[model samples]
Target: MIKLIGILIVVIGFILKIDTLFTVLLAGVATGIVAGLDFNQIFTILGDSFVSNRGVSLFILTLPVIGVLERYGLKQRAVSLIEKLKRLTTGKVLTIYMIARQIAGALSIRMSGHPQFVRPLVNPMAQAAGLSNSDELKESDEEAIKALSAASENYGNFYGQNLFAGSSGVLLIASTLTQFGYNVTGLNIVKASTIMAVIALVVATIQFTLYDKKLNKSHKK
Candidate 1:
């Protein structure tokens, strides 16, 4: 279909690095026009999306604060603290942090255990624990590894958070659904989240265990 082709064009154009964001926006507008929407309606849709996801803009402020905190020694503190614990393995430390991250999220605390924390802190600590040489990791590989670590934190947090009685996001969703004549309850959502979080924890633990075994074998070689 023409619409599907248009969607693929947007995806391929971005992948090809062909001025993607601007091009996609323009192409999307053109698609809307073809779908019988006027230019004014298209603009209104864009405006609505931007306004609805305004929380995204908070990233601009949050990033700078995270950067400043790192500059002031957050990374150093995390690594040094981990280093002092001689009994800890890299995988163990990450696994423990994963637990802590999930617990914090469940309590509705949006703690970002990401690049600022994990890369400069957790990954290096992990490498030190694993006795890994930085040179052994290709830049892309390192980035990928760090990205995985970051992603795990997000998963842990998202799934863990809302285990509490009053997570704002959970409440907001429940309230909105109720208003729309859906009988969703906060406790119901929280209970489902707890089940999902347990499943994810089991799965993630298995993955890390396998990865640790591979790293151990590599270290022996």
Candidate 2:
């Protein structure tokens, strides 16, 4: 059907590596025209869809603010703050953050996350800690530290959130089990989640300790 022309346009545009937003908008407009909709109708449809899913665009609002903060030395300040703590190491910093993240998530206090917290603050601080006693960090080593910081947030959130009584994960588990003919309760899910979180914390602590040892040995050489 001619109406399916938009799908072909999207596939071609992506394969050609065109700008994603422009490609989608062009495809949508073309599809509307082929379906006998005028420009006004097409524009109205686009506006309504955007309004319904505006939450996805929420991150755009934060980018400018983050850029302004960076321009004002936000990352440098984070690094400087970490450098003042002579005994902190990259592994120790991330491990502490992981624990704090897990605890906060369990309490349903998700004020810290990758974009809002880790990128703007945690990654820089962790990098500074790694570079504190060393001559310089290799590009690979810097990237590894950033990767670990991001992983810490993910690990903490995954295992921790279910501990909250009203967490969506608990509901999903209960709902899924019910669908499968199991009468699982929220309290049971919370109990299981809490146990899993404890195990995760222990494993994370051990990994961090080993990583710290490795970093120290490398710095000494």
Which structure among the candidates has the greatest lDDT?
2
Candidate 1 deviant stretches above 4 angstroms:
1-65, 132-144, 172-183
- Candidate 2 per-residue C-alpha lDDT over 1-221 given as tens digits, one digit per residue, 9 for 90 to 100: 99999999999999999999999999999999999999999999999999999977777778788879988999999989998998998888988898888788778885548778799998999889998779788887788888888888888888888888788888999989999999898888999988998898888878777877777788788
What is the total number of backbone clashes in candidate 2? Answer: 0
Local distance difference test scores for all models: 0.72, 0.87
Which clashing pairs does model 2 show? none
- What's the TM-score of each model vs. the native? 0.59, 0.74
Residue-wise C-alpha lDDT for candidate 1, range 153-214, written one tens digit per residue: 77677778778758886898789989999998999878888889889888877776676676
- Residue 206 alpha-carbon offset, candidate 2, angstroms: 1.3
Candidate 1 clashing pairs? 105-161, 106-160, 106-161
Predicted structure 1, TM vs. truth = 0.59
